[model samples]
Target: MGEVTEYVAGLHEPARSSIEGVFFIAREVVPDAEEGRSYGMPALRYAGKPLLAVMEAKAHIGLYPFSPAVIDAAADLLEGFDRTKGTVRFTPEHPLPEEAVRRLVSLRRDEIDAAIGRRRA
Candidate 1:
């Protein structure tokens, strides 16, 4: 987005915007989270560990879902696109599917609750 930062740089606008959207939804879904930059991308932390991270790649942008629940919920969206537990790769030419984005955020909220419940248990 901008010049080389102390934490994150080497990112272009398309990737930067994609990361920004991911961060926006993540914050809405995971308020109270500690947000920061990691490896030149946005990272969301809960309980002192990574809950999610976003990065833009040359061919695609990656939205990393740290929760299995989010992946399962978005299985259909992953049918043809590149994917991983820590990444959902897509392109700036074709924006990440909006429905998929909402699903991810919804699932993440559930995952956070479940993890909190597990910790309490």
Candidate 2:
């Protein structure tokens, strides 16, 4: 099995399903995103950068986009969700919506693309 699959499989119950759900949405948003580990967490890389990362914490599942600005921009959709500067925390009982996941991934992707463009300019 791949690293992501192995990581998700190692988790128990709701956590596994919750992580998988987020991964599913990310894949839908960026079909060509490459899967691997980032900072030891399962992540999807797009445009040669980490697009999203998923991890299970003691109480919630954490979604990391590695972009505080993207999280800030999605404040409306994150109303009822627990969030930190670079991570969004949601419980298995209250998983993040697919639409929210899609928006987060897309926004991060755009941000990365913009940064790449700036570097090349």
TM-score leader:
2
lDDT of 1 by residue, 65-121 (tens): 676667877989777777776678887676667777768766765676676774322
For candidate 2, report its TM-score: 0.92
Question: Residue-wise lDDT of candidate 2 within 1-121, one digit each (tens)?
Answer: 7668888889899788889989988988888888887877778998778899999988788999999999999888998998999999999899888888989998998898898883422
lDDT of each: 0.66, 0.88
User: What is the Cα-based TM-score of model 1?
Assistant: 0.70
- Give the residue spans of candidate 1 off by over 4 A: 1-10, 37-41, 118-121
Candidate topping lDDT: 2
**Native RMSD of candidate 1 (Å):** 4.4
What are the root-mean-square deviations of the candidates from the true structure over C-alphas?
4.4, 2.7
Residue 110 lDDT in model 2? 85
Candidate 2 contains a number of clashing pairs equal to: 0
Alpha-carbon TM-score of each model against the true structure: 0.70, 0.92
